[model samples]
Target: MQFDRKDKNDATLLDLYTQLLYPRMVEEKMLILLRQGRIGKWFSGIGQEAIAVGSALAMKETEYILPMHRNLGVFTARDIPLKKLMAQWQGKISGFTKGRDRSFHFGTQEYKIIGMISHLGPQMAIADGIALADLIADKKQATLVFTGEGATSEGDFHEAINVASVWNLPVIFLIENNGYGLSTPINEQFKCKDLVDRAAGYGIEGVQIDGNNILEVYDTLSDLAEKMRKDPKPVLVECLTFRMRGHEEASGTKYVPQELFDLWAQKDPVKCFEEYLLEQRILTPESIAEIKADFKAGIEQEVEAAFLEEEPVADTATEMQDMYAPHPYQPVEPNQQSAEIRYIDAITDALKIGMQKHNNLVLMGQDIAEYGGAFKITDGFVDLFGKARVRNTPICESAIVGAGLGLSINGYKAVVEMQFADFVTCGFNQIVNNLAKTHYRWGEKADVVVRMPTGAGTGAGPFHSQSNEAWFTKTPGLKIVYPAFPFDAKGLLLSAIEDPNPVLFFEHKYLYRSLSGQVPIGEYTLEIGKANLIKEGEQLSIITYGLGVHWALSYLDEHPEINATLLDLRSLQPWDKEAVAAAVKKTGRVLILHEDTLSSGFGAELSAWIAEHCFEQLDAPVMRCASSDTAIPMSKVLEESFLAKSRLKESIDKLMAY
Candidate 1:
C-alpha cells in the first residue's frame, strides 16, 4: 500500500484516499478514547474529513491556514505528530498551549497555522492581515481561513470580507456549510440559497462545490491558490457538507430529523470515496483492511504515549511566568537640546521616529491616511510612509484590532488609533480576549500599540469624553500609559511601540494642543513602570496620573506652603508600587485622584493597595478625589460640575488638615 515517488506524483487516487482516511481513522480512535474517559471532549469531524484533508493537501506549505475546531483533518494532513496532538487533547504539559487551551484552539508558527478563537468570525479578518503582510513584503503567499455557515451572520465576517475585497488581499474565505451550528439549522442561519451567494455583496468571486467529493475540493482549491499567489484577491468558497455526528459526542443528534441523517448516511464521504477507489483498482478490499490495521496500531501507540505524559500542574510560578512577553525597562534620558511642542505633536514625532526605525511597522485608523486622522496626529504620516504602511481602515474597530494581532503574529508591529477613547468599547472583545491573551494562551507575541485619545474637558458630549482606563486596567496582560506633559508623552509612546506586548496609550484630548513642554528632538524612551515625582514636599502625598497630575501641580503651585509631594504614575498596569509606597511612607497622609467616576474607579484600586501595603505608615485614612458617578453631560456647566476638579481642592485640604 506504500506509494513510491513516481506513484505520489500521478496517483492522486491513492494519495487523496490515504490523506482523507488518516483523519477519519484518527477521529475513530479518538472516539474510543473519549468513551473510555481518557480525553475530556472532542469535536467530531467524522463525516466531513474530505474538506479539511483536501484543502490542506492542495495548499502550499509556506502559506498560512487558519482553522476552526472541526478542521481536525487539516492538522492530520499536515502530518503533525499524533503524540503531541493527543497530549494537547489530554491537557498535558507537552501540548502546544501547555494545557492553557484545549482541542484545536491553539496555533503553531512552525506549521504556519493560526488557530481560531471561540468567537467564530474574527479569524477572517486575521487572515486578511496575514495576507496583507505577505502583500506588503511582495511575497507570493495566500492565506486560507475557515468558518461555519452560522458564523457568516456575524459582523466580523462582513467587515473582514469587505476589507479583504477592497484591499484585494490574497485570502480565501472557506465556509464549511455543515448544515447546523450546534443545534440551529441552516434555515435559521441565513435566508440565501447558498452561503457563497453572500460573497457577491462583498464584490468577490464565489463558488460552491460538493464537499464530500475529495477530488473536487482538491482540484478547485489548488487552482484558486495558484491564481491568488500570482494575482492577489479575495475569493469565497462554500463547501456543501453535513455533520453526520453530533456537534460534540455529549450533544446527542436527537434534534436532527431521522430522514436527513439517513439521506446523508448514504452519501458518507469515506464510504463513497472507498467505492471509487475500489472501482478504479486504486485500493483492494484486502489492501484497505491492511491500511486500517496499520493506522489503528500507530494511533494506539501514540495515544498510549500521550497518556503517560505528565499533566499540567497549576503552580503559581508556572501560571505567572508568561502573562506578558518579557519587556525589560530600558530608560533613555531626554536629550539636552529640545524644542517646546504640544502633546499632539509629541505623539506625532514619536510615531515618525518609530516608523523610520522599523520598516515593518504599520499604522492603521479611520481617516488616518489622507485626512490625517480626526485629531490630525497623523496628518503628514501617509506622505512619509506611503499608503501601505500608513493605512486608513474602516470604522470596524473589532476587525482592525484583530488584524493588528494578526500582523503581530507575522513579526510585524502595528499601531491602531481609536479616534475617541470612549469608542474603544466596540473593540473590547479583541483587546481583552484575543490581543491581551495571545502570549499567555499560546506564546504568540502581540506587539500591538492601541493609541486611545482620551479624557473629558472639551464639552464634546458623554459619548466623546470618557476616562475608561479602569476598564483595561482590570484586564491582565495589557500595559496602560497616560502621560500628561509633552516630554513624557513622546518618550513613553516610543517605549510602548518597542514593548513586545499589547500597550494602550491614552492621550488626553483636552491636552492635545493645550499642554506644551521641551521634548527631545531625537528618539528617546522613558521607563514605563516608573513614577515621576513632579514636585517634592513633606506633610502629604498627592498620587495621580494623566490630567490629574496637571490638576495636582496647579493646586500645589497655588498653595506653596501646603508642603505636599506629587507623584505621577505614567503606567497603570505595572504602576510604580515601590515609588508610591516610598512617597506614602515619607508623607503620613495620601490622596488618590482621577477623572473617572468616584465609584469603582482606578483610584479605588490604588486606595486598596495603599491601605494593604502602606497601612501602618499612614497617619490618616487613605483619601480619593474623583468625578461623580453620573454619566458625563454635554453642557459645559454640567460637565464642569461633573468633573473631579471641583472636589480636588476640598479633598486635598481635608487630607492635609488630618
Candidate 2:
C-alpha cells in the first residue's frame, strides 16, 4: 500500500463531514445522559472530534486501536454501537462490559478495538505490544494509540516509545494535545516545545498536525499508518486541539481562561471543517445543514434505542466469574509427591516441562535467552526451545510486560521475567490495570506468569533488594504466589502456568540457592488457593507464606514447648479461609507475619480475615509481625534490623503469656 500525503478528493467531503459530526452528537447525547442520570460521569472529547474521527478513518478495519478515555469519537468511527457504549456508561448489560466495566472502559474483539484503560499513559506500551504481536503473526495491520499531551510526561510513554523505536514496531502514537490536561496547561507539564519533538529522542519520526483540520489529520495519519505497516517503524503525531468542555461531566471550566476558550471555540473543528468544505465547493450550505441534522437525528435514535434496549442478563453473573476462560471452577488434586531439588533448578524444570507440554507458552526477559537469565533459571532452554519460545527482550520493563499482555491476548502463554521483584514497579500499570483485569473487564483471559526474584537480606541495596509481593497482592484478579521450598516452587509455578489468569510468581532471591527441599521428579501440580500445614500444633497458629513459613518453622523447632501450627499460603488470592479458620480453631490463637511493611501489608488482610471469621476461637488479640514502614535500607545491619524474624517468635511468646 502506498502512503498518501494528500487528502481524499472533494467528492468525499460530505462523507467526511458526516463522520466528523457524528461524534459531536454522540458527545452531546452522552452529556444529556449524564445530566438526566441515565449514565455516570464521562470525559468529553468535544473540540477534538476531528483528530479522533479523522485518524480512525485513516486506518482499515483490521488495524487495531487503543483509545484513551476521551476518544468516544474514535469508538463511534470504529462502528461500536452507540447504544452499547451508552449501556456501558449506564452500567447495564447492553454495554460492552456487560455492566461491569467503569464508564468509558469498553472493548470489542470483533471490531479490533482494544478498550480504553483509565490510566493515563500505559496504553502506549500496550499499543507497542499489539504491534509486536501483529509483526509476529505476520499480519499487515498497524496499531494506533491515543493519549493526551500530558500523558507524554509519564514514564510509560517514554519507555514504550523508546522500545517501539528500538524494535521499529508498526505503531503510531497520536497525542491529542488538547491545550490542557485536566486543569494544568501542557506547557507547565512538559519541557518540550512540542510533544512530538519528544519522540525524536527515541529515534522515531515525529510530526505535529492541526487537530481541527480533518483533512490534514486524515492525510497525515493515513500516510503514517500505511508507512508503519510496510516499513514498520514507530511514529509520533501530536494533534494540537482544544478541549471545548471540562475534563469530565462533574468538572467545571471556572479555572480555564475565558479568552483562550473563546479562541478555541471559534476554531471548532466541526465549524472549521464545514467552512473548508464549502470553500472547496465540495459541500454547499444546504448540504452541510442537512448532514448536521441527519447526524443529530441518528444520535437521538441511538439514544432512544439504548434507553429501550434490554440489558444482557449474563452481565450480572459475569461479575462473580473467575479468571479461568471457557470454565470458571474445577477442583484439582493437591501436591503429594516429595523429593529433594534445588529451588532455582525447580523453576527451570517447571518452565521446561510446561513449555514442552504446552506449545503456546513463550518465555521472555532480559538476559533470559542464551544468557540463561540473570539467576540462570532459564539456562540451556533457549537453544533447545528456539528463540521464538525463549526470547530475550530489551531492558524495558514496561514494554516487556505490555508485550507479554499482547502476546497472551493472541493465544500465547507468556512467562515474563523481571530480573528483580523491586523493578516490577516499572511495569506496575501493565500488571495491575491491563493484565490483571483483562478477563474481568473484556471477558478475555490472560494466562501470563510474571516471575520476579524478590526479598532482601542479600546486601543488594534498596533498589535491588526489596520484597514487593504485597504491592501486587493488593490488585484484584492477579494470583500472587511466593514459594519457600523447592517442591512448592515447582508445583505452584506449574499450576500458575496452567491456570488461565495473570500470576505474580515471586521467587525469593536468597532462598533460590540457600533453601533445599523435596520436589517430585515427575509432573506435579499444586492447587492455587490452598494453603499447606507445615506443622500441626495446639498453642498458636502462625499464618505466613514464602520465607516467613521457614522462619516460623525454625522457631517451632527451637521451642519444643511452644506448639505453634504453621500455615504456608501458596496463593494470595482465593486464599484458604477454611484452612485458616480450622487452624485458628485448633490452636485458639493467630499471628500473621510477612516481609513487607506494616502499613496496609498482606498480613493485615490475613489478620482481618481471621478476625472476621475465627474471632470467637482467639485466646488473645491477633498480632502481626512485619517490616517497619520504610524503604528497605542498603546496609546489611539495617536490613536485618528492618525485617521481621525471631522478633515474631517474641511476639508469639508475649501473646502466649497474654
Residue pairs with colliding backbones in model 2 are 339-518, 339-519
Looking at model 2, report the run of 10 residues with the lowest lDDT sum: 1-10
lDDT of 1: 0.90
> Per model, how many backbone clashes are there?
0, 2
Error of 1 at 31 (Å): 1.3
Residue pairs of candidate 1 with colliding backbone atoms: none
What is the TM-score of each predicted model, taking all chains together? 0.98, 0.88
TM-score of 1: 0.98
Q: Quote the lDDT for 141 in model 2.
A: 78
Q: What lDDT is reached at residue 517 by model 2? A: 74
Which segments of model 2 are wrong by more than 4 Å? Answer: 1-12, 30-42, 99-102, 249-267, 276-290, 309-339, 386-396, 559-564, 597-600, 620-642, 655-658
Across residues 192-246, which tens digit of lDDT does each residue of candidate 1 receive?
8989998899899999988888877888888899999999999999998899888
